[model samples]
Target: MKLISWNVNGLRAVVKKDFAEIFKELDADVFSIQETKLQEGQIDLELAGYHQYFFYAQKKGYSGTAVFTKQEPISFKQGLDIEEFDDEGRTITLEFPDFYLINSYTPNSQPKLKRIDYRMRYDDALRAYMLKLSADKPVVLCGDLNVAHEEIDLKNPKSNHKNPGFSDQERNKFTELLDSGFIDSFRSLHPDEAKYSWWSYRFNARKNNAGWRIDYFVVSQNGKDLISNADILNDVYGSDHCPIELDLDIKGE
Candidate 1:
């Protein structure tokens, strides 16, 4: 199965770009999106041969997520069920016959670590949530997790040590998550590679390849062997973030 996860920054904005063409080009079996930045009754996307599931934030034009899949899931859940977190529409869990596919848009810890506390709480909650789901079946969690996990994850990790995504607090949480029986798909496949999925728009960052590997395809340890390939599609562009792809040996079901 071919899976894709991208932080479009804004669904409406990227639509103005060549989103349609890119979507068609990738042709993912399951295409997960983050930071949709839309409300109900917003722009309607006509993606043929796909089932669309959207979870919009309570606040209009804010954080949101969506999934377009060629295979219809047995069932789908829209939120984490935590009142505060659910308000932002951060996650969507789709239950297939074999596993649970979760699409998420993690909350960012703003500059100066202003929201670090809340971000930490969110990390813990999401960790517990994934663990719970893993107990039943393997879970495939994909999206912009909003953290540059290790020193190698970002271009200049030394300078960004205390920054939001590269902060020690966030990085440790990621380690904890992996210890709790999850595998960072990309890292598992390409151990020494330093590819990135998100780049800052300023200072010609993309041109210089100064970016952060924030987006991810995290799979439960129980399902690690299913992953065939994990990659960062740096050449594709629409938002500040590029799309990450994961191929699994999972048969069509």
Candidate 2:
């Protein structure tokens, strides 16, 4: 099975940038998108062959996520049970026959670290949610997690240490998530690959290859053996963030 995740930044903007063509070309069995920044009746996307699921934030034109899958899931969940955290519409969980696929657009620690405390709380709640789902079956967690996990994850980790996404606290939360029972699929497959999935739109960062590997596809330990390949499609264009792909062999599992 093939699954792909991307933070399109904005759904409407990317649609005008040939997102439909890219989607057709990739033909992933399941494609998840984050940061859609749209609400109901805003834009109509004609993804013919895929079943679409969207979770929109209470706030208009803000954080949101969507999932398009060729194989319809057995069940779908919008958010964690916590009402406070669910307001942002950051998560969508799909329960397939084999596993749970979670598409998330993690909250960013905003300018001046103003939202750091809230972001940390989000991390705790999200981790607990994933763990609970994992107890039932393996979980495939994917999307823009908004954090550069380690020095190897960004081109200039030293300078970014104090930055919102690269702060020690955020990175450590990611580390703890992996240590709990998940495998960062791309890192497991390409241990030394330095290419990134996201680049700052400022200062010609993308052109200079100054980027951060903030997007990810993480699977529970039980699903690790089924991972066949993981790839970062840095060459693909339209958004500041690129798509990350994961292939799994689930026939035997």
Candidate 3:
């Protein structure tokens, strides 16, 4: 099975930039996207042979997530069950016979960590939610989690030390999540790889290869063996973030 995740930054904008061709080129069994930044009826996508599911934020043109799968899910849901967090439409869960897939767009802590408290609360809630899902089935969690867990996860880590995504608190929470029985698929596959997925438009960040590996495909420990390959498609671009892929040996019912 091939699963892919990307933070489109803005779905409508991507569509105008050959998203359809890129989506068809990837040809994944399950494709997930974050930071859709759309409200209901904002746009429509016609992806033949795929089941499209969207969870849009209550706030217009803001945080949102969606999933497109060739296989029908046994069940699915939106959000982490907290009203405040749910209001942002940051998560979507799809249950297959063999595993639970959670597509998430973790909230950014913002400038000067202005939203650190809320971001921390979100981290706690998400960790608990993923644990609950893992207890029942191996979980596959992916998206622009908005944090670079370690120094190796970004270029110029020293300079970005106190930045929003590289803050000690955010990184520690990510560590706590992994410690709770999950594996960062990309890192596990390529321990010394310096590849990154997201970059800023300013200062020619992408051109200079100065980027952050914020997008990920994380799985429950039990599901680690199922991952055949984990890749960062940095060459393909429409948004600030590139697509990350996971090739699994598991089968769906």
Q: Which candidate is the best by lDDT?
A: 3
Kindly list the per-residue Cα lDDT of model 1 for residues 1-253, writing each as its tens digit.
9999999999999999999999999999999999999998898999999999999999989999999999999999999899889999999999988889999899999999999998888889999999999999999999999999988899998888889999889999999999999999999989999999999999999999999999999999989878899999999999999999999898752
The digit string of per-residue lDDT tens for model 2 on 114-231 reads 9999899889988998899899989999999999997899999888787999998999999999999999999988898787999989999999999999999999998878799999
lDDT of 2 at 98: 82
> What's the lDDT for candidate 3?
0.94
Ranking by lDDT: 3, 1, 2
- Which is better, 2 or 3, measured by TM-score? 3
TM-scores for every predicted model:
0.98, 0.98, 0.98
Q: Where is model 2 poorest over a 10-residue stretch in terms of lDDT?
A: 79-88
Q: Relative to the unseen true structure, what is the C-alpha lDDT of residue 82 in candidate 2, on a scale of 0 to 100? A: 72
Error of 2 at 120 (Å): 0.9
Better model by lDDT, 2 or 3?
A: 3
lDDT of 1: 0.94
Worst 10 residues of 1 by lDDT: 244-253
